[model samples]
Target chain A: MIRKALIPVFMLMVTFPIALLLLLSFGKSWVYPNIFPDQFTLQHWNDIYQINSELLMVTLKSIGISLGVSSVVTLLSFFSSKHISYSVYKSRWLFLAYIPYVFSPVILAATLQFYFTFVDVSGTFFGVILAQLFITYPFGVLIFSNFWNPRIKAIAELSNTLGGNSWITFYKVVLPLSKGVLLLCFFQVFLISWFEYGLTALIGVGKIKTLTLSVFQYIQEANIFLAALASCLLIIPPMILLYLNKRFIFTNQQTI
Target chain B: MTNQLLDIQNLSKAFEDEHILTQTSFFLQESKTLSILGKSGSGKTTLLKIIAGLEKQDNGTILLENNDITTLSAHKRNIVYLYQDALLFPHLNVFENIAFGLKLRKINAQEVKNRVTKMLYDLELQKHIHKMPTQLSGGQRQRVSFGRALIIQPKILLLDEPFGALDVDTRKQMQRLCKETLKQYKITTLFVTHDLKEALIMGDQIGKMQSGVLKTFKNKEEFLNDPSTGIKEEIEFWKNIHANEE
Candidate 1:
């Protein structure tokens, strides 16, 4: 009982920095001694909103890139995983899929940077998307492959016998059965794309200006306030996405 | 005969040098129930999979109505295999799950609605038509699973201990429901189980499997009244292994 009580306290303790950043985002100055900011001003937010349409464009670009990366990752994973699960050599393919995940992203990026430059595709949107897709595809494959095992195959076969074709079985039966896992995959890929800095920065070569890039630039300029605000903005979409995903997961769990 | 909807001839399967089934043969008559009874690892499921075209036989022939279906894929064979788990589509409501097969056939919306509605009503699942699979009880989920399979109206219905997960009471109820429903549709069923009582209750003819060979009986009385020492030994083997577990 005490452990349960202490959980929220622990959570708040860990989240205080983020919360403080969010709070400070609405304030003009952070020099106040009080626990809360004395003067709450939307001046920073308003300035970003009014002076820089670039910020909005960058935010949208980040979201667009994330969406593109997630969709490609999900599709690639779904097919590859489905193939792996149904194929004769499932174990071998699965082991191969695990290789990318074991390597650190830094090492991966450093190695791939040379290849991207050789292909004359380095520091472009396509290059970043491709890199992130490589990173996120394995997750999609792993999750969906696990989700696509014999149990799901049984359900699918049942559907097929009932007069469903392969496409029909996939969309109507297999996809729905693994919706939760797919959602989890989408959110995971989205988060990976959203927060991904080193790979994008390395491959993007300052050509791509995502929210993370904006935050990093502000931090480099010693503009902590702007950086905090940008970070707060960056955090909101994923937070909302995660919260929605939790609601879905919990609701499904309860139904089960 | 025209009535023999499925025929298996000397089918064999092996998994990584382990022979799961060998030289198995059977014929499933239309609208009749054939139950496969065996101890665990007796290769009952492997035989069913070979018949269903889900797993390939290293050497054998499967004929659907005298047409060799051995080379046919699972999807093309029109054989439905129900798992021990209900394996319902979690995202779809019960009605949608039941409608899954019809939709694949490109059936019209009106037809789908009418057929699914009839199934829901017939299965006494009207209240659960909108409920997700997770919202259903064990019995209810099994009924939905049955509905999903039956809705497709497959040529062959294969059950891999479909009621094994349910409580005793629910299992009994589901068994009764399954018998009643399949009888109405006149669907040919091939079910595998370790439970003698389930075999007796659900099977019109029982195929007693040892290792991979099947010794079939016309009825439960024939199986029980057999004076052959081999029959007695097989029954004892199954009883000692399966009956005591529950």
Candidate 2:
């Protein structure tokens, strides 16, 4: 009975804060130490669509970067993992693949600063994307390696003997079979790049101004309402992506 | 010699210092079933893989239709190997799985459909034609796998204990289906099994592997009389059971 009661209690625990944040975003005069706002208005929501709203610009920018990072990471990982899984060094490569995570993204970005300048992508949007790629592509590799098991190897051989060359076998056999896991990997790496701050902060030198930077800017300015609004904006895309992905994962294999 | 479809000559493979196959030689005739019996780790699977071009032998020549095909890649070898597990591609339905090879050959969509439809009925899997591999029972899945392999009309079919994973009843049913299909197609088959009875039932000629050496018998009488497989003792033991029942 207690456990059953705890379910709704836990729901309230998560939702209550989100409800408060929603109210604050629209609240005109929310005062300290008050459970409810002094006044409510729609000005902040209206501010989102103004001709030159920085928040709107930052949100669009973040979406663009997130989409790019997800595409490059998922694609590169798909091809790389296919080779790695079939390669003799399949499991052994995980040690090298995982080394990126050993350093905080900030630390890694800092160390790679000189190399970034040498390639002339330093402090640029491209530089930040590249940095995020370095840190997150390994995740795709790791996830994809698990997807490419001995059973998959057998299937690949089956396809080959059925008269498929490497290209035909990969696109027809591996790519289609792993589509669900690959889509899942896409969403996962999207969220990683979307939520990332430390790497962008260091490598981008703050010129790249992602939505996370906007939230941080509001926090520094002590505008808690706008900060909450920005945080709310940041959370919505992932929540939606996850709800759709939940249906997909349930419809497909459970291994992921 | 002229009728031989696959001739494996002086095949040798080793892992580190351990010899898995040493100077192994065998000749399989066209349209014949050759059953190989071996204990686990006796290089049965390795030999089959080598024949299918999925494994490299340290030394050997694989002659197919009198051509030295030892260096041919797996896709070009025209040999299909079925594993112990059915390994039906989970992404495809029964019909699609059956038609996978034809699609790869770029056969027209109508022909692919007609052939796959006919095969589904022939395999008695008409009801599950649209069902995913995961939705089928073990026997049904293996039948789809068998259909998938046979539809390609490979020059050689390698079975590595393909029915080993099924229950006894399913195994027996699969064995019957396998024998029937192989005979119907006249597919040159090399079936590797650890079960003596399965070998005897499926084989036109039976061979046994001990350590890394393989020996084939000319007939069932020779196989039954051979001591290496302990078949003579096994038959005597069964006879005792029948006598005790009497």
Best DockQ among the predictions, by candidate number: 2
Name the docking class for model 2: medium
> What is candidate 2's lDDT per residue for B132-189, written digit by digit as tens?
8778999999999999989888999999999998999999988998899888888999
Chain B, candidate 2: TM?
0.97
lDDT of 1 at A21: 89
**Model no. 2, DockQ:** 0.60
Question: Among these predicted structures, which one has the highest lDDT?
Answer: 2
For residues A62-171, write the lDDT of model 1, one tens digit per residue. 99899999988887888778888899998898887788768877778888999999998897888889988777887788888888787777767666556667887777
Off by over 4 Å in 1: A1-54, A85-102, A246-256, B73-76, B92-132, B151-153, B169-177, B215-230, B233-246
Instruction: For model 2, name the residue pairs that clash.
Output: none
Clashes of each: 2, 0
